[model samples]
Every structure is written in structure tokens, then in C-alpha cells.
Target: MTSPPPDAFANPQKLRRGLSRIWHATGYSLQGLRAGWGETAFRQEALAAIVLVPLAVYVGRDWVQIALLAGSVVLVMIVELLNTAIEAAIDRIGPERHELSGRAKDMGSAAVLLALLLAVGIWTAAIVQRFAA
Candidate 1:
């Protein structure tokens, strides 16, 4: 594969090496989770995930099915986090309205909606297969 552009390689954050990089990255990821908890929508999805992940284990008959079920639940939370990130970035840009900012936020919201729908479909199918068969 082609190497990243020189400018990309020049990122100052990339200077960290080895275990220091991994430890710092883990801390940063935790910080992001804390930030995500501050968003109401993300908090709600996280709470739902707490319940649904275990349900997925119960509902699924095999490892593949379990992974698909659990992954779908996590996917909704992932989308919600991304949507929250987009909104936070736009908000940080300033409170003033702009067409592009509005559109970006709208698209992010749409992504979360789609992820939720997909999760619902997957879970519903799994449930039906488990009980309705």
C-alpha cells in the first residue's frame, strides 16, 4: 500500500512511540467515552447496550449469530458516538448558524437513525429465529 502523504506523517501526536503511545491512546479513548457519556443520546444508547448485549448472548444459538447480534447493538452506539462527535465539532465551531454545519449535523443524525434501524432488524430476526421457528 502507498504510504501516507508526508503532511500526514508530520502529525505531532504521532511522535509518541511504543507502550507510551498505547497507554496514552487508551487514556484518550477513555476520555472520549467520558465525553460521550455527557451527551444524552449517547448515554441512552450506552444504557441500552448494557441490556442488549447480554440479551444477544441469550438469543443467539451460535458464535456467529452471537457476534452478529452483539455487533449490531454496538454498531448503534458507535454511530451515536460519531453523530455526537460531529455535533460537538460543529458546536465548537461557534453557535452561529451555517448551512454546511446544519447539513453535517443532519447527516450525522441520519446515520444514527440508520444504525438503530439496522440493529432493530437484526435483533428482530434473531428473536424470531430463536422463538418463532
Candidate 2:
């Protein structure tokens, strides 16, 4: 009997040490970011982040506060990227509409929404505490 093909997933472990792995990983991350940028919703969120992240540093009083503010915004971006990835994978499964696919997409969207809500809540609390209280 013929041996099965090597697992594509196993290739990461085969990667050599030093600058090459870092270079390849960085390239893959950039590619993912580019793919995410192609989606309109991701583009809008990224644009918002470009503004909000800088504003976070200014608004926050201390390192902890700044971290909270900036981290929340970053969390939103991370969730958005993950959601986009999930949607893309679902789309790759097939063009036909299926309940599971719809559910998966909807769930991914909900995750993004929840992340946004968390970020908003954190920002609001921090702003009010710093200024109002």
C-alpha cells in the first residue's frame, strides 16, 4: 500500500529556526491582514482603529488606563479578523446556502458585535471615571 501524503498542518513544525521562521510568519500575518483589509467591514473598523488607538493614549491618565483603552480597541480588531476568517472559511465550503453556514456566519458576526460592545463599555467607563467622577 502507498503511504499517505504528508499532513499540510505538520509543516509548521518542520520550519527551521532563526530569521527564516520569523520572516515567513510575519509574511503570513501580513497576507492575512491584507485579506482582512479587502473586506469593507474590516476596512471600516481598521480606519476607526487608526483614529481610536491614538486617541486612547491621549485620553487615558496612566499606563494602566492607556493599556485598558488601547487593549480594548485592539481586541475589537482581533475579533473582527477572526470573524472575517470564519466567514471566509464558511464561504469556501460551498456557494450554496446552508443552515450551518448561515449559523456560523451569524455567530462570527455576533462575536464581533460583542467585542465592540466590550470595547465601548470599557472606553465609556474609563472616560467617565477620568472626567466625571
Candidate 3:
């Protein structure tokens, strides 16, 4: 049997230390954000977040309401990011189409859909509570 190829994460000791680790982690996160931003869906969701997050604050009467509204938006972004990562990993595995790969991607997409629906429901409930009541 053959061994796996070497990569940056091969050695645990090579990891950064202290503040350097934090700095590198932050850079990596920014890189991920940039990569996600390049995706059309992520860009659209991000734009929605930019609008909705502040609107949450404006529409919510209390801190709890504001947190619920804003948290739902963040949850969607988190789910989308995870979904993107899943698709990227599946793509990196191979170009050949496989049933499992398609299923994995579909499941990831479903997760994003659920998250988005939850966000919409949360926002609608909050809005109705604040205005319709």
C-alpha cells in the first residue's frame, strides 16, 4: 500500500505558537471569507446579511429580540459556509460523478435551505410581534 502525500498540516510541531497562531488563524479565516465571497450564493447571502443584521436591530424592541433576529442571520451564514466547504471537499476528491457525492452535496444544500428558512421565520415573527401586535 502507498502512503498519503505530504502537506502543510502534516507536522503538528510546525503549527504557529501564541499570538502567531492567533494571527495565522485570523488570516486563514479571512482567506476563507474571501473564497466564500467569490461564490455567487455566498455573496448574495452576505449582501442580505449586511442589510438584515442592522434591520434586526432597528426592528427589534428588546435585546433578546435583536439577538434572535441577528443570530438567525449568522446561522444561515454558518450553514452556507459549511455547505461550501463540503462541496469543495467533494470536488477535490475527484471529478467523476458519484451518487454519494451528489447526496452529500444535496444534503449540504438542504442544510443551508433550512437555515435560511429559520432565519426568515425568526425575522417574520419578530417583525409581526413588534408591529402587528
Backbone clashes counted, model 3: 0
Output the worst ten-in-a-row residue range by lDDT, candidate 2: 8-17
In TM-score terms, candidate 3 sits at 0.89
What is every candidate's alpha-carbon RMSD to the true fold? 3.3, 4.0, 5.1
Worst 10 residues of 1 by lDDT: 1-10
True lDDT of residue 78, candidate 2: 91
Estimate, for each residue in 104-125, the C-alpha lDDT of model 2 and write its tens digit.
Answer: 9999999999999999999998
How many clashing residue pairs are found in candidate 2?
0
lDDT of 3: 0.90
Best by TM-score: 1
lDDT of 1 by residue, 26-122 (tens): 9999999999999888899889889999988899999999999999989988898899889989999999999999999999999999999999999
After superposition, the stretches of candidate 2 with alpha carbons farther than 4 Å from their true spots are 1-13
Predicted structure 1: lDDT:
0.90
Greater TM-score among 1 and 3 belongs to 1
Model 3, which residues run further than 4 Å from truth?
1-9, 12-14
TM-score of 2: 0.86
List, residue by residue over 31-99, the lDDT tens digit for candidate 3.
999999999999998999899999999999999999999999989998999999999999999999999
